[model samples]
Target: MTRPQHFGWFLARGFGPQGWGYPSLDWDYDWTRPEVYQEAARTLEQAGFDLVIIEDSPSLGSPETIDLRVRHAFGGPKHDPLLLAPYLFQATRHLGVVPTVNPAASLPYTSARQFATLHHLSGHRLGLNVVTDTGSARHFSDAPQLGHDEAYDRAEEWLDGIRSLWHSWDDGALVADRATDVYADGSRLRPVAHRGRHYAFDGPLNALPFTDGEPAIVSPGGSGRGLGFAGANSDVQLALAPLHEKSVRDYRARVHEAAVAKGRRPEDITILFAIQPVITSSSEEADRIVAASARPDDAALQQIARKQSSDLETDLTALDLDRPLDLSIFGAHVSRGSIQRLIGDRGEDAPLRAHLTALARAGRLSDRTGFVGTADEFADLVEELGDWGNDGVLLWGDFHPVTLHRTLDELVPILRRRGLLRREYADGGLQANLRSF
Candidate 1:
């Protein structure tokens, strides 16, 4: 028997050009306008998705790599996702809108007040996709640049300060006495004075107290420190790992262990693994697609290089494909994990062509592991994960109507039939929707 699972959409490109690289760009919806995303949000709500997480990165990389970042519109020219959340809220009532926010870019007091206002306006449908990106610190004045672990430390302090401000108002702070014409009891507000290594602030937040609950905390970090942070503070963990049953169980156990260490129940946090399934029309078509990718030609290799270049902030297309890639070509700031992902299990002496060809190879759905499949095959994978005690799966793509429909159109009804997807949402905003199952 399959159990109902939570679903979400990851706006993988941030607020950048939607449909730019895809054929859907011909649809001609202005990426700067909100209508495209609004339509997408409504579609997600109708499909019973619980939330939409908008990805953001404030910087385009150093001057040397700016060309690689934006040449394909892969990384730069992004508007603020936080500014776009309200439009999504105005468009849908139950689906949560989580915009990526970095502590290094904004002060604690400002984040608390702004988030509090959106939380109220959205009726507690706001969520924060907290990120501790150290690369963009230079964009903010007087922001300190820290190492990886240190960055998480600063984020911890920043979140602590924000929570303190959110809780500054006491239980009786809002005593609206009708006869006395008093709107609030100022005496009941508690002052927040936070002095931490990364931040210093004082606030009895001017924003009103939350009637339902504070905005849900969503985090995407797989590191030890990242998992620890999720265990301690997050309500949703954006997870990524191999989709095998044992792998899923092991990963959930690690997260549960971390939560238990922090005195939190395992059920307190929803672990939604990130998956991007390639939906095909038929098994034969899926087989053809997988077969076509087995031997990538030079053109296919170049396209792969372009994407990898944007991600690593290094121009890989210019490198000699016949020679072993010089790992030192990557800058000091490039994430080690990104480099490892590009290399995979390939040997250190392997040529660049070998790496790109391995990446271009596709797997079949009959294997019950890889993502290339028809809707029914995809449903089989979802049901198998449910049997493994999976919490949910976050489908990744651009926040465009075409992308939403392309992925969910056939897959949705199939999952619904298997009792793997929700048909209706319960009230109480994002948290309630998450806890409904």
Candidate 2:
């Protein structure tokens, strides 16, 4: 029998936003309405996806150059992903809703209360994708920017404080006694006090107890400190390594080892490799599609430039694209991984203009890394990744509406027949469903 695997959609684009600076496709999606996201959630639920993560970055790039940011809408106008939770929860029964929350910016007490409240309201089907606010230093005016290691240090303490606040009220603390007029047992509640290196919180949370223990914690980071934070606290970790089998296996081993060292079982943590599948009727058609995506127009190049500038934390508009890449221009705050993934072995010595030209023409840096084939062939790829010990895959495709619809309607059936995907949800909430595997 084939082993079943978990599935999730990386809703980074807020459930298919229209005119979002991508090459022209077959469909136009209006993402401003919540119904679009609701429909997507329902479709995923029907397809037996494990969860849908809502990514949010509140601040646009540097104020000095906000025009490109607004024009591209990459970091500009973003609806708070948390606002869509209730809509999704009301629309679907089994699909888990995960909204990214930053620990460094938001207070631990507020996060603890909000997430716990969401857990109760959503019938114990909530997940928290925790993030450390390290980039965009201008956004956090109150505090100085922190190094990667220090950011994780603060996040560790922040998570601990949040957990303490969650436990302030015991499970059986609520007692609505009409005859005695006692709403809650006072003995079961206590204030949480923590004075850590980075955070200080003292509180018995002003909310009732959570229905399902606590929301499942999700983390996304590939750095050593990032893996450490995830291994210690996260129930699910997004593995964004190159989609090579050896690379994924090596990363999984590191995560498992870290969890084991922390006195936690390796199997208890789920690692989902992020992938974008280019599905078509045949291998030749898929190749044609991939080839087309590589030839982006002038408008497309501008969008890529804007997005790259944000990722590297430097304006690329000023760079002479035709000249050799000036490594000094990036300063000390550039995203090393982003640049490495782009140019590969060419490194910083490659021509700057050639890189942008290639990016605009190719559309994405990882065009070759993603699986490209028919639905059945793509299923084979998913199973192969499972063999490398991945819990499942986080789908991040730039799929057209028709393509996305077919993925749910056609591709999922293939996986179901192969016994690699679930036909129905297990009898429990998000945490139980996630840990079932």
Candidate 3:
């Protein structure tokens, strides 16, 4: 029998325009309103998902690239996901809502208080998807931008400071003695005075102690320092890698090694790989979709260019497709990983058209853990991951009802029948739900 695995939904587009550039936009639900997302949150909880992780980029890129970021509604004009978490909590009973938060954007004290209040309000189902994107430093009062490793170093300090505040209220701090009308014991509160390299704060956090646990910590970093940060601090590691068994096992092993180095057990962190699978009705239909993608026409290639341009924060559509891309066109702030993903197996010398075409190509479900498949075929991959000692998977897409149903309607029952997806949530909050498996 296969052990059950956890499941989550990733709001890949963040709190930006939903259903944009898709046929579903015709559904006529206002993206700015709370009702659409609330309905989707309810649907996810009913589907037995453990959490929903929201992705955010606090800045619209530097002044030079703002147009590329939002022209196609790919990157910016995002309302804070942190602000949307409450509405999601109001709509669902058990689903955890994790919003992306950058350490540089807000003060540690402010983040701690706000997150603590939400964690308590949501019955401990809140999570913080901590990110270390230095690109948004300019928006935060000209915060000092650090190098890659140094950013992680600062994040470590930032997280430590937050945790210090969370623990400032001791276990017995809340006495709640009705007989004497004493709500809390002041003596039990510890005065936290932290002076770190990255941040300094004094706190006996005004928020009360968490009865269940502090808000869950989620991290998405794949670098060596990134993995180390996840191992030392994260409760859930938002992972990205190939879905093949060996690759999955290797990635898990690296996280485990890092955890052991930090004197933590491997099981302390749940590693959830991000996947965007194309679910089809039949194998033949899946085959047809894959075949059509092998040679994308001009229109399809241009569509791909728009997305790539948004992600790279550089315009690819304006470039001559026949000529090789000049690496110098990308600004210093562009993510190296985003650039590498755009230029996959092909070298930098390859023409821009070749690179885009490679990205446009699609693979079959039977092709080495490929994603294009029927529901049963997709279940096979999920079961295989469970057998490989995998923790879980996060399905990536928009946070709209249409998008959720399109993916989960056919896939959920198949997974549950195979004992791969959870059928019910446990009593504790999100952390409890993750650990219940």
Candidate 4:
């Protein structure tokens, strides 16, 4: 029997109000309130998505100065996803809440305790997206920001410490029996004396054992270091859905090979590509919608510039948008992955200035790839990906409530009818749902 494809949503605008595709999103609406996100989580539960990955960053930059950050509200003023997870869990039963955690910023012992607590409370409907802080390391503390490889190396030790703490209290340690006047089996509990290059933890976690087993682990980075870590550790790996067939095959194969080398079956780790679907009632209508959404105006273009500058960690406001950009100046600060996707093979000796200028002019605020079509056509795309052995997709376009409802109400049913998506959730929480595929 063919396994049903797993589905998840990458909630890009956790609580942000401004983003592409949603023009009518209320700017004054309070993002701190639970109702804003709870409604979306409940909708996903109805859609039968396996999980919702919430992204966060402590170092939201002010690239073009305070005005840019305040004007765009791009990545700042963010609420803690941990505090918001409970609301989502309370709003829905099966939709797993996976929040990104930067190990460099949060201690492993604290992460373990918090995740374990959520696991117990949510019946194992929890996942942690381990992230090595890429933003300024100074923001995390006084510690210098380690290089990319070093960050992952430290993350490896951090994860080991967390696992040790989690296992400190063995199974069946909690025996609430009044007859013996004892609650926990003291002998079964042990302490984790973990001291590593980056972190040190001495003793057992001051928390109950995780209920319904360990919460699912998700790894999203695609760097070489990230691939190795994900292959060895993550239950699910989040990646960008490629635009070409060869890219898809190569990416999946590489990750599977990594898993195999690590003594893990390829099936043990599920890979979900990030996608956004532009759904409409008909092909022509979809095309018309796409056309309408295209060609953003001057104000929007400026916002895009601000956002790109923030990501590149350099202010491009003063640079001539039309002149050939001196690529040497950007240096290593430019994200290599972003460059590959945007420039592709056309970047060989090409002037880099036009690329950045083009991005701003085109109003390409985000790199999130999407399919614009009728529901049936979108289903075909999903089926094609599954046929290529891709596990599933993670959807997110805008933070607008309408987009979430339309995806759940219109696109989901089409996918279910075509047998490309699960019609109902599995018997347990997020982990069970992920394993069900």
Candidate 5:
């Protein structure tokens, strides 16, 4: 098989909003500016990217303020992202539309139908980002909380139910069999029944599928109970890790382990580490954009990385980095599950305080791993990643979810010269471009 080019794009107008190739959120100004957002979408479509996913979240536990030390960039769509998919997909061609949906937060039966409908409308250009939220149970909206384990258990059964529904009707299930006087083929349609502790449902999906199979499923990332859900059902691996090579390798390896632990083919799961992109004519120019005492933090260097504050921000800065981190400070912002992994990854001498400081010093923490060099260097980096082990990268940039304004001027041209990245997009959706290669 021809080696695949390994790179994709991610956008959450809330976090690293400006790094993408389009207009980012202006929390103080106008994120509601539809025309501005539309223009940005056009820019990305013209760039020949693989996909543009809309990220969503309902809570804002922390303030959107940035100190010189650190910030939480979480800017997102003010409206329902699902409603916007067909519009975004239609406004431009070849850009796949990925919409992040917390499985537990929404009803699967309804989602199954909506996604099936989306698949039809987009001509099979839709992809799903399945995020199983572990923070709080959504059993009750105004509802009660389901235990974490129970929630995962629900996801397992729910995923099975949805898949069965998606695949229920075969091609041409809607037959105009005049002789039989039947509008549809009853024998071809089947109902799926799945029973579990939290929920149970069974039925043939109400709609016919446009895609041959389920829209390529992407695991939005989770741990403990969540990993099992991802391994069994996901096709793409999603994560936010430090940009350093070691961090990328570690996440890819962990996700691969999850895939292998189950009976699933590990190759079916592609590891995608998120990076807030920072492109420039030269590496120095990129640095200049964020003029800071330290490396202008990736998203922190921008205005929005501060949509929420992790508890470690202030305390870690206050404590002596020379000392060490006290994991106890995570009482509210995080749980112990977030600690053991950090300790194991960083080693005993490396204290939690140091880790927090490092993250603050480098805002490129989540999705921090991306093209940081001149166009030529970045193009080579993308090529190198394919040689290494990455399936592709999910890129963002500071202040905006776009990385293009600089990329088009600096990187794309170089990539084209090298015959690596495309100079002109082929006529079709993002998948047609990807699968052909």
Candidate 6:
């Protein structure tokens, strides 16, 4: 309970219409070039953001599907975020670095050791976004099939083994008691023998006690089984519902309530939602950007969004505004909670074409569907989303570095003017910055 902070938020870009996503899925990636991404990371940290997260997927969609497109792997030869985030720590000073890792790629023992080292190397500024890849097992070089919830079932053992290893190096355990000549107290470190339904691991990870300020866990479980697992252990309960402040608020409150029922403090977990922000000098300019994005010929919204449509004949941009929406043409199966959210509001009698177009419109234009407007209005949404229960919102941009700079150059100043966001950082490390609240 170090941070009594009323609000907390982080910025990130992955799965946007831009590089990390579209190109990863085998589209053009002119927006997210290497230098642009580096600059984007630099700018977000410089803007005094609490943290910036980078994510990964060994195989985006299901790797086993006969169709290569089914895996939905974004970007060609995508880099590893686990390896990428750590490299940024020394380059940028304060921004908390979190990387999403596919646990199935590396066992818990190895993952824990690496992250524990990251916590130490980064001055306790490391964070984790845990995603159990049950579906990815089929892609592995040497692993049997693990079902959906089955992956999460193994996560319990993974976490238990990982936590024990982190705690193995207890307080003052590594002291150089000169006269005592004790490098570490042998009695303090304990072995964790974990034999669970899905996994079995003996002893501790090959890492010293992360000592202090180990990476905080961000639990985001989208399914029913995942929820209970996440609710129990996450420092931040991360999830994205439809783009409604009310739903965002209610969902977060439910997560907090779930933690309370588990005999844990509600404030122990923070709710953070995904928000795509497009900022401009005025509302008109922002609107134009949204309009263009909503109609981007290259967006591939119907396909890129994991939507259930293929072989779309017409250019969605040519759609006339007067037509009714038909929701049936789009097949019943689509991924992400967002699809369900959009479909819930569909009219039964609506034309499938119109409904599909609107859904396409919503996905194509990042700013159009998100909190968009002038700096002031954008700030208002940030505050409102916060008031609704999210400690903070994750920012996704259409263009990598340019859009990030806009936030620093325009929106951040406005937020500072309103006395909402901090202009200067508080002294202390990650814990100190958060504890100041």
Superposed model 3: Cα runs more than 4 Å off:
none
Candidate 2 wrong stretches, greater than 4 Å:
15-30, 176-181, 291-303, 331-334, 353-369, 397-403
- For all candidates in order, the CA lDDT equals 0.90, 0.75, 0.89, 0.73, 0.58, 0.58
After superposing candidate 6 on the true structure, give the runs of residues whose Cα lies further than 4 Å from its correct spot.
Answer: 1-37, 60-76, 141-144, 242-245, 287-344, 347-352, 360-370, 426-435
Candidate 5 lDDT over 1-437, as tens digits, reads: 22545356665553223333333333332444344445556776666666767665543223422332233233332355676677776776666777777666666678789888888777677888765554434333545555556656777777777787887887778887888887888688877775766556777889875544457677664466666667777766676665456766777777777777888877767666665545656657655443442443443422322321332222333444445655555544243344543454676578544444344442211133333445666666666666666676677643132335654556556665665555455444444544545
| Arranged by lDDT, best first | 1, 3, 2, 4, 6, 5
- Global Cα lDDT for candidate 4: 0.73
TM-score against truth, every candidate: 0.97, 0.89, 0.97, 0.90, 0.76, 0.78
Model 4 Cα shift for residue 185 (angstroms): 1.6
RMSD of each: 1.3, 3.2, 1.3, 3.5, 5.6, 6.0
**Which pairs of residues clash in candidate 4, taking residues 3 or more apart in a chain or in different chains?**
325-353
**276-325 in candidate 2: lDDT tens per residue?**
66567776777676677676665666566777776665777777666677
Best by lDDT, which number? Answer: 1
lDDT of 1: 0.90
The TM-score that candidate 4 achieves is 0.90
Q: Which stretches of candidate 1 lie over 4 Å from their true place?
A: 142-144
lDDT of 1 by residue, 1-437 (tens): 87799999999999989998999999999999999999999999999899999999999977887988898888878999999999999999899999999989999999999999999999999999998877777888664578878888888898889999999988988988999999998888888889888788898998998988889999987889989999999999998888897889999999999899999999999999998889999999999989999999999999999989988888999999999999989876676677887998897799999999988988877796468999999888878888899989999989878998999999999989888889988878899988989
Question: Whose TM-score is higher: candidate 1's or candidate 6's?
Answer: 1
> What would the TM-score be for candidate 6 when compared with the true structure?
0.78
lDDT of 5 at 38: 56
C-alpha RMSD between model 2 and the true structure:
3.2
Give one clash count per candidate, in the order shown.
0, 3, 0, 1, 32, 15
Write down the TM-score for model 5: 0.76
Q: Considering summed lDDT, which 10 consecutive residues are worst modelled in model 3? A: 362-371
Pairs with steric clashes in candidate 2: 294-361, 294-362, 321-353
lDDT of 5: 0.58
lDDT over C-alpha atoms for residue 397 of model 6: 45
